[model samples]
Target: MEDESGIFARESAYLERYVQLGIASGRVISVSFPAAPEDDAEPDHPLLERVVAYLEGERDDFEDVTVALTVPTAHRTVLEATRAIPYGEQVSVERLARTAGLDADSDDDRNVVRDALASNPAPLLIPDHRVRDGPSAAPPEVEQRLRSLEGL
Candidate 1:
């Protein structure tokens, strides 16, 4: 498991909601901080607990065992990481914010991008389907929300 400190833990409320609702989505798992403290003795947050359990395969029946999607810290941009797609690699606004170093936890900013994507559509040349959650490859809706972030 990666350290949560250096990784700048994204609030990811939608991800929590999706996971709570049993929505399966992929993710880009990266170990940003390898030397951070471990809280394995007791999970502090529900999402943290779920993430730990999921990574350990304790929740196998509830989610997929294979990690199909992943992006390392080495790849600065999602589009840069997904160069193999050839064409139609939609870069969401949220990704832009993350690239520009914005607050990923802000609902208002996230919604702004979502609204822009829903309204304009073409600037988002890459398909939302490509943006995985972490390593598990979350559902389309999760990726859609990610790609819909504002000012990407």
Candidate 2:
């Protein structure tokens, strides 16, 4: 497990650390940091190593890891665009909507983007933190730490 230092070290209402891997694809789906730590958590998983490397700032990108997400059809484009955002980069909701081929000027599209990010099932894997105007599903401090890791 990665050291819970800096922003991660602090206790938050949502700080639950656990790894969820896809059964069929054998890929990491979500790595949550909830308030209370779990006892007897699984310690050895290949994907956990990668996730640790990421949180510890030892890795720059998660492109090699496949993520499992069940986004609604309306929100799929926004999530896909968010997933495409590179490590350390940030984009506004309008820009993200444009990247997803949605109308950048349409409030509906921007709201869709925001809603998608706010409800992201796979937080770190999809990197909704990279979206500037969109609401983050992860804790704000965690998001800031991730941005700092990327030097964004």
Q: Which candidate is the best by TM-score?
A: 2
Per-residue lDDT of candidate 2, residues 1-152 (tens digit):
23221111222222234444332345444556655434534455555566667666665566766655677876877887888898878998889999998898998888888898888877778888888777888778777766777776
Clash count, predicted structure 2: 6
Q: Candidate 2, residue 69: CA error in Å? A: 1.7
lDDT of 1 by residue, 55-121 (tens): 3333222122222233333222333323222232444455644653445577765554343333221
Give me the runs in candidate 2 sitting further than 4 Å from their true place. 1-29, 38-40
Question: Cα deviation in Å at residue 123, candidate 2?
Answer: 1.1
lDDT of 1 at 80: 30
> Alpha carbon lDDT of residue 107, candidate 2?
88
